[model samples]
Target: MKTLKQLLADKPKTLAVAAPDDSVFQALCVMAEYNVGALLVLQDGKLVGIFSERDYARKQIRNQRSSKETPVRDLMSARVAYVGIDATLEECMSLMTEKRFRHLPVLDDQGQVLGILSIGDLVKETISAQQFLIGELERYITS
Candidate 1:
């Protein structure tokens, strides 16, 4: 029943971003610097799309497109899956699984981007919750 807000609070507050018109190479460099697999494509401070390592491999590398010439808008995934702060972890996980996405941008009610969530983040939270539940059950049974 944990919410996306709770999960985000546990993570380091950093969101790597790139301009939509930025070169794919520039975006990739930012990703490398941040040690993140994806970068949010922002245009005029709005969330426009997402560029990930997968996109680079599929759109640029596979097509042999020059990274410096390719724009993030052309290579980024435009159909982004967004998760609200109020959304449950289960909801986020289900959406990600159904969509086959490794990253989800966290949004607020006002459609403002807050943070990004990765499949790894969801998995870690699920495991922690399961452990807490198991511990509670064991204590209850022993008592």
Candidate 2:
């Protein structure tokens, strides 16, 4: 039952963001340079939407839209799935699976973003938790 806070503390915070008015290319470049799958669309210091690689492929490439001239608002996922700092790992997993989204923006109670999590991050945490549980059970049996 680890919380998002613990995960964020264990992993340093890194935010990738772009203004709502920014071009899709700009956000895409930021994501690529950061080696991340998503970008937070910010406007007036508020989280407006999320632009993911999947959005680029589906909305831009598949649709034959021009990434160079397209706005992220047109391609970004507006109703993104998110988690709060106090949310349990289970909630995060459920939201991601239900939404079919690979990344989720973690926000504070005030809607201020804390950090982002990827599917890989969740998987790694799950593996770590399983390992710890196994070790604890092994020690209990040995004792």
Candidate 3:
């Protein structure tokens, strides 16, 4: 399986972030614009939390909180579980599955934010890898 570093390198380098004090609505707009499901809550260029559509549905809407008035920090998942650049795809998948989370922020050796990965990203990579391996096996058999 590919490491987190490899996966990130293959992906686009853009990262969508939101300020802690930004309104939830503002964060939602950024998420929509980026076509992403979550945004890292950054404060002083550091990862503070993560806000996702799940948070909006379970925390904001369920609690009847106004997204326009509430800050992203209020709804973001504060205790984030992140992985290092060298972490394997299987490790990430296990952690995410155990935690029941859809997203994980990737960090470098110096704890700098590299990027974020979603469950969808992992699944797509796994499927791609399987397809490639299958094609290789078929070619070997034909040869």
Q: Against the true structure, what is each candidate's TM-score?
A: 0.93, 0.91, 0.93
How accurate locally, in lDDT, is each candidate?
0.88, 0.85, 0.91
Task: Give each model's clash number.
Answer: 0, 0, 0
Task: State candidate 1's TM-score.
Answer: 0.93
> Which 10-residue window of candidate 2 scores lowest in summed lDDT?
61-70
Candidate 2 accuracy as TM-score? 0.91
lDDT of 1 by residue, 1-143 (tens): 46787778878887899999899989999999999999999887789899999998888856557888888988899989897788888888899899998999998888889999999999988898899999999999999
Q: What RMSD does each model have against the real structure?
A: 1.4, 1.6, 1.4
Candidate 3 or 2, higher lDDT: 3
* Full-model lDDT, candidate 2: 0.85
- Candidate 2's clash total is 0
Residues 1-143 of candidate 3: C-alpha lDDT, one tens digit per residue: 57777888887898999999999999999999999999999998899999999999889866566889999988999999999887889999999999999999998888789999999999999999999999999999999
- For candidate 3, give the lDDT of residue 75: 90
- Compute the lDDT of residue 98 as modeled in candidate 1: 97
Give the per-residue lDDT digits (tens) of candidate 2, residues 1-143: 46788777776566889777788888989998898888988888779999988888888865555777788899898887788888888888898898788998888889988888888888899999999999999999999
Winner on lDDT (1 vs 3): 3
Model 3 has an lDDT value of: 0.91
